[model samples]
Target chain A: MFRDITIGQYLPGESFIHRLDPRTKILSVLFFMVGIFGLKHLYSYLFVLALTLTVILVARIPLGYLLKGLKPIFIILIFTVGLHLFLTPGQILVEIGPLSITLEGIMKASFMALRLIFLVLFASLLTLTTAPMSLTDGLEKLLAPFAKVGLPAHELAMMMSIALRFIPTLIDETDKIMKAQKARGADFESGNIWQRAKSMIPILVPLFVSAFRRADELAMAMEARCYRGSEGRTRMKQLVYRKTDLIVTLGMGSAMVAAFFFL
Target chain B: MIKIDNVIHTYKKHSDEEVQALCGISLDIQEGEFLVIIGHNGSGKSTLAKHLNTLLIPSEGQVLIDGLDSTDPDMVWNIRSRVGMVFQNPDNQLIATTVEDDVAFGCENLGIESGEIRARVDDALATVGMAGFGNKEPHYLSGGQKQRVAIAGVIAMRPKYLVLDEPTAMLDPRGRQEVMETIHRLNKEEGLTIVHITHYMEEASQADRVVVMEDGKIVAQGCPREIFSQVKLLKSLRMDVPPMTELASILNEAGLEVDKTLLTVEEMVDALC
Candidate 1:
């Protein structure tokens, strides 16, 4: 059940987007999100949407697989579009019972849905193309300048990588705990919200205990291999910006600029 | 060489109870020797394994990796890099998502250049029989594969000595055999001193020397033949002898002419036929 998470999952490939440097993708995604939020026109979003779809096509990510990631967010999409459809203050275009469907309402609802869709697509695109460790490494390099003001950038990156490493292990552990609790007649499902939350206490307590124990053991193991906190560390896969990264960055910048002015 | 000079390790529990985990444990580990340590639970075997790499400094004694003092704070990383450690839990010891990244963790910590780290990571992965598994994640690998990756991680640093604390305790028979074979190759081909801690008698029988621990002290230390010959004493110390050794002892008890110290199936077949 926990494997249903598709946000952080990577679809390994040898496509152009995959070959782009992780730092370029991470930075571009950040700017893209900010830029998308600032756009005010439908046509402006259409341009960005077309660009994102083209990138996804270049990345060779199957549409079916990409849309599978939106399953969990479908309800939120429906709620946002539904609220905007009837509550948007605009001229009425059609009458259905007391709820009048206006042209402006239709446009606003579609805009909201499009923004949400774009948000998820861009986020997933970044994750789909970049490996989690590469992403963390890019973040570390980007955040390195802040280390002078006591940012603990290396520590943060180390923690993120470790967390990424343990994600599967912890998920398996949770599944085991849930199974064991079920075997002992513990009802996790078929309960009210409060009851379900309370039922998680048993699983959480053991998970936390095992997590702390794992943390302690992992710390010792790291120390045994002479891990002294990234002070003098060097990566085997060094992050180097290639010509592809430069072109990708420039193209993305110009596209965002065009979208902003064209609106 | 590891000179564990009368190392006495003491730690206080959360209840404020002072526990003496190691009691003046001194053993001279020669360079390029495969030494197996066996004991029951809480026998200071793990505590001693931790000392070889300076994971835990001796509370009242000294552990010297080569000639450097492990207790000296400045030399901890130096000592550790020279004496790498692989712990029992395969899931916990891995520090990176991918096998190559985890293997390079040690070399990265040592600040080796990117080019050299890449070479060493590939070499280390190949040495552990995990060459093509560089891009694989830890969870996708079997228990043996994960443990081998952990071994690869340590060997990437090119340590002179490798200390393993119950590395096979969590593996199945096949997985355990895989790890044992890899370790034997490391000791023979790479010429790395091996300090292996395990309760498995078969693994101990393959060691060049066996050190038995009990109640925070070394109870016996000798060749596998000498250690397993005293089956009664080992059993009394809550240790299992190799199956062949036990069978040979039974044959000896039943008025048969058999060497009670025989530790392998071939030896038993020779004795019987």
Candidate 2:
């Protein structure tokens, strides 16, 4: 059950999209989002959808993964569609005794749903192709200018990378603690909501203690290696832009700009 | 060389019931020597191993690696770099998701260049027989493999001395063998000084020297043959002599001639049969 819940959702591959510089991919995703929100017409929405689908295909990621990414948003989608059909103000397309479905409401709801779906899909595409370390490194380089304005870009990126690296480790810890509690006959299921919540205390207490212990260990380990932060520290995989990065950025930039006028 | 000069450690000092974990323990460990330390729980063996790498400082004395004092603030990094530690829980010591990444953690902390880090990581894993496991996630690995990976992490740092604190206490029989073999290989082939603290009598039997601690004091120190031969002394200290030694003693009492320091099950069988 936990395996389905992918964190940061990185799908490993050697596709052209995966090989693009993380900086370019990040900027293009931002621009793609702009195109998503800029769609004021149905034609524009279609264009954005086409562009997103093309990128998804070129990424070589399965279509099912994108749909799975949307699973959590299903409730919101249903609620919005229901409110638009029953409560929105517009020319009524269908009438019952107390409920009327309006054409404008239908169009608005469809547009909203489509926009949200594309937004999530585009974000997934970006994460699917880039590794978490590369993403953080790219952010550090991109945010270098902000350091001049008093932002600790390197430190922030370092924090993010460390956090990313520990997610899987922490998840495994949680699983172990849960299993341990389960072995002790701590009832997690088959209880009232309050009882279940109380049952979590056992798991949480140990998890918290172990987490603190691990943080202490990692800190000591880091200090032992003489980690003094970014000062005088050089990385092995230095970030360098490639030709594909520029081409992808230019392609996406023009598409977004074109989306504004033509659609 | 590793030297401990009157190292004393106390826990919860300032409390009415303060505990003295180590009472002026001193020993000299030569370079590339395999030294096994055995003691009952709370005997200060763990505390002593922690001092080898500056994980804890002696309250009243000093620990020196190659003449650099562990208690000195400036040399803490140098001391730790020369003496790497692996703890009991393989789960806790392993900090990376992938086997290779976990091994590279020590190298990363040393701030080694990427190319050198990669090479050292591979070499470390290869030494532990985990060469192709660089990309495999740590959670999926067995207990023995996890411990080996932890050892690999320490080895990647290329320390002169390796200190393990009951590392096999958390493993099964198979895992225990895997880790013991790795430890032996590092000591013998790589010529690394090994200070291993364990409660297992079998593990200590093969050490170049065995040190027995009792109530924060060294009660006995000698080679395996010398230490295991003193069966009565070990039992008084609340430690079991090797099983073969016990069997040999019983056989000797029954008027049969046998070596009291037989270490392995195979050796015991050969002597009896």
Candidate 3:
């Protein structure tokens, strides 16, 4: 059941969007997010929604898979919509008991909800199209300039990549531990909130121990491979900006600027 | 080439209850030698292997790799680059998400150019029979495949010697065979020195030389045939001899005319026939 969650999952595909450089995809998402926040009118929100749909089509990600990623955020979206609906004061539209819904409130809530939805869709599209390795590579390259100012960008990126690499491994470990505990008559499901938290101790302790052992071994292996900070390290897959990347950057920049001014 | 000069390693050296992991070990590993070290758990085989790559400096003595002292702080990286080490768990050693990237890890650490790193990654992957699996995620790979990728990661650095500490201990029989074959091929075809630390007697029987450790000391060292022929000594040390060697010894004890030196089934069959 835990495997059904696919928020940061990458769906491999051969498509125009998938072929774009990771930097291009990352920058495009950034611009799209900015445009989403800048939009004041409903038409602009629809335009952004249409733009997200076009990206989804180009990436060839299955609609069902993308929607599955939004499942965890459904409650957050509902809460945002509900907060705006009841709190925003405007001309009255409906009255139910002590609650009053207004025209402006409805408009604001729907727009806010659409913005949230489009934000998630665009972000998911980026991860769906680009592999996690490329994403970290892009992040490292994008942050390389900050390293000159005493920031440990390379180390941060390395940590992120390693964390991503270990997610599935740790998940498998968790599943195994959970099953082992269950076989030993450990109840994880039948308890209050505090009791459920307490029940996790058995699983957490072993997992933490194994994780530390893995970290120690990994550190030794890395040292054996001559890893001595990021001073002189070189990457095999050098990130290069191509013609398509430039075009995508220019197009996205123009669209975002247009959304801010014209809309 | 590597030399261990009376190396004594103690864990928690400053503590009163320090445990001696390696007790007065001395050995020499020549270039292009396929040396296998076999021992029971906590016999200090891994501790000895770690000394070869400077992962653990000796508490009393010294380890020298290619004439450079492993204990010297300045030569640590140089020694590490020369003597690559692969650990038991493939999942832990593989730091990169993709196989190719992991293979490129050592080269990258050496500050090699991107083009050179790319070539080395491809060549190393091909050497490990994982040529087309460059882009595959390491998590999705089977145990055998992951170990192969880990070997590729080490070999990509073009190390003169590869020290594997029970690399196949966590693997299944198939995975063990895969890793053993890769190690042997690297030693034979590439002329790379291999210091393989393993618990499998069959693996040790195939090595050019075998060193048996007991209680953090070398109990015996000889060719596989000579080593396995001493079935009583090996058994006394709580280590198993090769299956064929054990069977041959049993047959010989039963008044049958069998060669106790046989390390493989084929050799046993020839001796019987």
Count of steric clashes across candidates, in order: 0, 0, 0
DockQ of each: 0.87, 0.38, 0.87
- lDDT, candidate 2, residue B178? 98
- Give lDDT tens digits, candidate 1, residues B1-273: 888888888999999999999999989999999999999899999989988877788998788777999889999888888888889999999988888989988898999999999999899989989999999988999999999999999998999999999999999999999999999999999999999999988798889999999989999999999999898899899778888888888888899989977878998999899
After superposition, the stretches of candidate 2 with alpha carbons farther than 4 Å from their true spots are: A80-104, A143-187, A191-195, A224-228, A253-263, B13-17, B251-258, B265-273
What is candidate 3's lDDT per residue for B171-234, written digit by digit as tens? 9999988998899999999999999998888888778899999889999999999999999999
Least accurate 10 contiguous residues by lDDT in model 2 chain B: B89-98
Name the weakest run of 10 consecutive residues (lDDT summed) in model 1 chain A: A254-263
| Per-candidate TM-score against the hidden true structure | 0.95, 0.89, 0.95
Clashing pairs in 1: none
What residue pairs clash in candidate 2, if any at all?
Answer: none
Native-to-model Cα distance after best TM-score fit, residue B201 in candidate 2, in Å: 1.6
TM-score of chain B of 3: 0.95
lDDT of 1 by residue, A1-263 (tens): 89887646888999988988888998788778767767888778777868888998999999988988888889999999989898887899888898988888999899889989988888899999999889899889989999999999999988988988888899999999999999999999888999999999999999999999999999998888878897787888988899988888887777667656666
Q: Of the candidates numbered 1 and 2, which has the greater TM-score value?
A: 1
**lDDT, candidate 2, A1-263, per-residue tens:** 35666657688799888988899988998888887777778767767767788888888999998889988878988888788767889899999889988998888888878877888888888888987777887999989999999999988987786676667777777888889888888788878999889988998898889888877877665555445567646554567798878888999898888777777
Instruction: Tell how far residue A220 is off in model 2, in angstroms.
Output: 3.6
Error of 3 at B97 (Å): 1.4
